[model samples]
Target: MSEAVAPRAAIIRRLSITRFRGIGNLIWRPGSGVNLILGGGDVGKTTVLDAIGLILSPVNPSTLSDTDYFGRDIESGFEIEAVIALPVDSAISAQVRPAWPWAWDGKDAVVPALDGDSGEPVYRLKVRGTEDLELIYEVLQPDGSTGNLPVMLRRSIGLVRLSGDDRNDRDLRLVQGSALDRLLSDKGLRSRLASELAEAEVKDALGDAAKKALADLDNTFSERSLPVGLDLSITGGQGASIASLVGLTADRNGIPLPLASWGAGTRRLAALAIAEQRQGDRPVTIVDEVERGLEPYRQHALVEKLQDSGAQVFVTTHSPDAIAAASKASLWYVDYTGQIGPLDTNKVARHRANDPNAFLARVTIVAEGLTEVGFASILLRRALGAPLSQFGVHISNGGGHEYTLELLEALNSGGLSFGGFADDENGKHPTRWKALEDVLGPLLFRWPKGCLEENVFGATPEGKLEALMADTLGDRTGMRRQTLALRLGLDAKTFPELATAAGDRLRPTMLDAALGTVPAGREEDKGAYKSHGGTWFKSLSGGRELAGKVFTLGLWPSLKPQLLPFCNSVRSAVGLPSIEDLPQ
Candidate 1:
């Protein structure tokens, strides 16, 4: 006979939840690998994972309360159902159990008489909570038949949860349904160990006084007409049993201590390590905030390891390190309305590598570079009365002009909520840029004529440009106008004549210098136009300072018309008050 092939692990192919907690209704088709859930706070990310755990949980008599209902309306009652793909030779499948015969072709369902005719043999498990706080767990057959899901079959599914705020190391203990107990189940180890503990010879270790105390207890038991006599043994009363007391411990020096004595991070890691060793079962592990007690490096490692574990995994994280570390995963985004959808990995690859934080927000502003990000952030803060985080808005640094446009296209293709900010580059790359303009419409904001430097300086009225230059020069005591002009490759000999030129006569010259019109000296060229040797306000901090100074010099009103609309668009997307709506 051919060698018998081992069965595969069970996986949840689809999850449907209704009237549960904050989620009114949601149907999620998660990938077979890792599913990384992300969204703003209270968006029902946790509830989705909790639904999966509750429906297929091995624990008997799961708890239910009125609060578990959506909007606390128990009249509708909550229901969580899942279509699970069972392993070959699975006991719950019709081939093994015969009663529940269901199959799915990844979309439609059918009841087949033979297992080979089934596209994908699946079992539908559902849990419903009633008005009186009662829970009913059942299996739905393809033939319109229903039956109670046996606890043994549920245990075979083996769903493990490492929940957030669960720092007590409960999973590491030998509790009724703990990972350790499951790992050691069907071995009769607990009974044998308990019997040996009861037979322990304590008299040899105790002193005469202690021995006499035990003898008096035995004599009192005999006088009470009890056939059994009491002696020194492990305490088993007051709801304390040997199974509850027995747990894994580590030794340090000469003393043994419970795993709970370790730090939270170590304890959780140890528990998960044991969970991974579950015999004959490949568990679906769900972790909430995997970065909770782990450092950056460990967080990355945890996600990568879980991905390679070959069993389906679901994890929720707000950490950028954890998000980026999930290089291969199904990125699911949940909005404030409890709608869940997958974020295409190809569409979000650039951001996952460079700006993973954007994936965690409800809406993002894809800024051309550090300058645009800083400039937009200052304007948003002034308009929104708070930081961008307060409104679930994130500013992603798109690194450059072309890169920003690419990110915008990706975001648009992925159907994500985003706004864009970039310089017109004096109309460079007009085709691609105009296409983006048409796609984004009002959500796109670009400078009209030139780069950031040229726009601000070019718009400044005559004498104000001179005043702005003086303000920018700050309090450098010996820094003369002549020296500055000389550094810009202007005629060093005619500095006096140029300084006294009429109107903002020097404004255009300064803008030219900023744009690299005059250049020669290697030292001067090293720091010039664009981000290199000559441009002012090129770096992130430099741009922020320039924006602050622009406001301080009362120049914001001049630039407000061109910038305000974009700020308001971002504000509107995040449900914040617009700039025009804010108190003047």
Candidate 2:
């Protein structure tokens, strides 16, 4: 038969804060997984977590007297605002308010102040003239009317008062007395079985019986029952016969023998077992400096056990081993500001994955955008003849300049190369370039002229070499060039319209006019195109003919052998160099 299952518990979803002590009224959304609140000793980290617990649980009168809650004495009260996620079955939203000590009457409970318009009851408690404690009940109905209090709400309030306590020790005792005792006590086990049997609605009788039977088996294994007259000596000089049941034997003199008479580690394990047995089903468990009082190996075991128990665990530590036992996402470094933010998991993971001696070996690459990286990778590969990915290139979209800067700073701190292109759409601002260069240092690189010119054929020399193929293959293979030309006002048609007309002919040009590359043309054609100041081809070479500059200095001399064939073919068509060995 299948075993009985326990109901899943709901977790606290959101924490809202307003005018709390030390904190300047802020709402923080904690992550779902294990949240590590990290900050310097007095940065209100513990205060935040305590406030969350307070909101979820009933208000303790001791909190009213707590110095931190109220600025000074308990009389000079302060306000606290918070909201908590409750189980769907529990029809109550968490709320709290201060109550004067002298506002409660003996027999009747005084209703706290209510919002007249909304009719929502605001929580407040007061001691009456006779010093009698009054339990005020206010009912806010969905129809915007103040109505009679629900019986369930009043009962729940009673439960809250009975269940809540100021001291952690008292709270632990209450938990142990209630659910823990019922789950772990032998008498309580029988009571559970009897209750299950009495409830006819519990259909799976055999399965229920099996659960009871298993509980009995667990009880046997859990406790040590000593046989009469066989005294056993526990480790640390505690004498008990139960130790013999677990393989501890007495010496020849009939004196009880110590279990640690076996091993010190075993004795420590026994103490841990006793502690776990004492702490039963508590909703939340706080383990401060859990790694204390244990060897490194034992500390690891304790962490594993605690994590496997499915309890909400909070641990504080300065040990690297403790941090290692926890996942990278769970490790948080406490900052001076008291704001618990995420740690750099990427760096931590890299360090763990690659045990590098020097911190510089942990560097990472961060880029501005995918396109900038796309072009940069092509350019660098063409210039260096090596794969850019070998350097660990990463791209971050320029959503905002601040985010790019933050990422760069983080990577640079880890000794990584960080650089990428930023758009010059804002007129090539010096401040923006300087800001990035300041963060990235020597790793930063950008185009000399601030922007790539309209026509761009390819990222590399090879791609640019292929771009010349457009002359033979027709303009069909150069869409990027044509599109860029149209955008920069060098082409007559718009990109979309041009693409419709020329198809794949819109290839990018390798030659950057901003880099002093001029279009080749006839001397007469160049004269017509020459600048008369601030005109098209004229301003390119100080009003000189475009053809003269192209022939004299624009084309690189190293390309002479390769360009001869293309120059001859193009010259024959346009009445310049013929399709023959002209230069070569």
Candidate 3:
């Protein structure tokens, strides 16, 4: 006989919060797969999880602690409202029928937003604090017009939270209601009685017999079913005749290893494994710092695993790998203003640098190349008196001028503000330049002439080349490491000699010889970046340090006028005072 298949119950479609912890007012509309919450610390990421836990938890919780109130103000009661769209025959519907908006669409799904629909038929759970400082939940009508719902209707919503710290508490023990016990029950029911067991005959086993039955069931189901290892059985007390559910006792090499003895990563993964079975008809799991205590590969795997668990997963993180692993549509930014919302991924969005650090930043500096990244970042640090992380600024090298627009598109769609510095050489392509100009407007910064090596560093024959090089010169270690300098045919002392021998072989820019791509005698056309300059720059590992040299070399005083627009743009993006605001 086939095992009975349990149907997925309706999930929470929306969550509204007011004056809860750090949040003043916010609404979260989560999608399937994952909703990755992002922001700096204390921006209400954890508050959101706590608020959801307050309203939809399976087990009724204790009274609210002082810290649970927003601003710890016991006087100003906080509220959280969630809309759970119920199906026609929803298990919770019988208890919640009075509160439902009682409206349905052509598909029989509630369409509160449909034309002329008076009220949306959603099961709304509202939690608030009373004057006596008591916390009570009021299940209001779908239109939020009435309250005092039946007590049983509160169980209609299923929410499981993996607290950032104490996930070990979720491990196996059918006695204390382990998440494992919840999953092993019929139709994923959380029960403490014989009727809830998946196999009725195994319920009466004492000790060794219980283990035997569990072992037999293991053959039919692997740990992959939950995707976290939780092998369990019921054990009788040492001196007693009664059986008790064994919680979180597993072994490796015949040695018993308890859940408490495991590391944070292991315990967290196990909690998710147990919680995976918590969904009977409906399931929603909220995890704080999902990437905490996880390795790099595990971080990437975590996103994929949560999305496939057949439940709505909400998570918060500061890890860039997690940001990159999450789709643009799934990310929500919680800023200082108490706004939590989705990014617009429908447009041609781009993130060329592919750096997770930059992806999570509220603002980005889309540099034209690697050298520019190092160059602009060093300047930003010097000006800001701290790293870019402090200001939520990320410096990204878009690889080249061609992908600049793509990066901007992505940054925009991802709800990030971006400004860029590109070469004057890019004016050659009007189509691309116009696109950049139209989107960026006055935000774009252009080099005075030619590329960074010439304008920013100092162009040869026109710029104070000798002084610039002498001032910006850095220690040369990697240049000799592994014949790197020789491989690039670079020796500053031999440049003039190579120039004499190169004759017409060098491009008009003489950038080929500057970059050391071709030998002095070779007859070919190439720019500095195309040949030796690219490798040589990578070896320097001091683009910012070199960029710094420009300031002391007296280049900034002259170049300041040309770069004022870019500097102001950077200041605006980071919410800092503009260069114009500073006294001369």
Question: What's the candidate order when arranged by decreasing TM-score?
Answer: 1, 3, 2
Q: Tell me the tens digit of each residue's lDDT in model 1 across 162-220.
A: 88874566677776667787887855766776788878976679999988888888888
Across 47-159, the per-residue lDDT of candidate 2 in tens digits comes to 66555444433323222334443243333333333222223233344323212111112212233234322221222211111112222223333233433333333222211
Q: Per-model C-alpha lDDT, please?
A: 0.73, 0.36, 0.59
| lDDT tens digits by residue: candidate 3, 1-584 | 11112236455667888877777777767765578887656557888888877776554565667676677887887888777665556545565345555342222224255454333355666778654667777766545466664334554445556678854455444433335545554432333433344344444444887767766677656744743332534333433211124447679789988775677777777777777655444457787887777887887877778777766778888887776676532767664344575654433235512555544556656788877788777776666657878877777777777776565655444333457777777356767666666766556776756776666545233234333333135543233221232434545344444345444542233433234445454445434335545433432254665566567555676566766667666666566777652122
Query: Best candidate per lDDT, number?
Result: 1
Model 2 misplacement above 4 A: 1-7, 18-21, 56-63, 70-282, 351-584
Better of 1 and 2 by TM-score: 1
Q: Local error of candidate 2 at 131, Å?
A: 17
Q: Show the lowest summed lDDT stretch of 10 residues, model 2.
A: 158-167
lDDT of 1: 0.73
Q: Each candidate: how many clashes?
A: 6, 26, 7
Candidate 2, number of clashes: 26
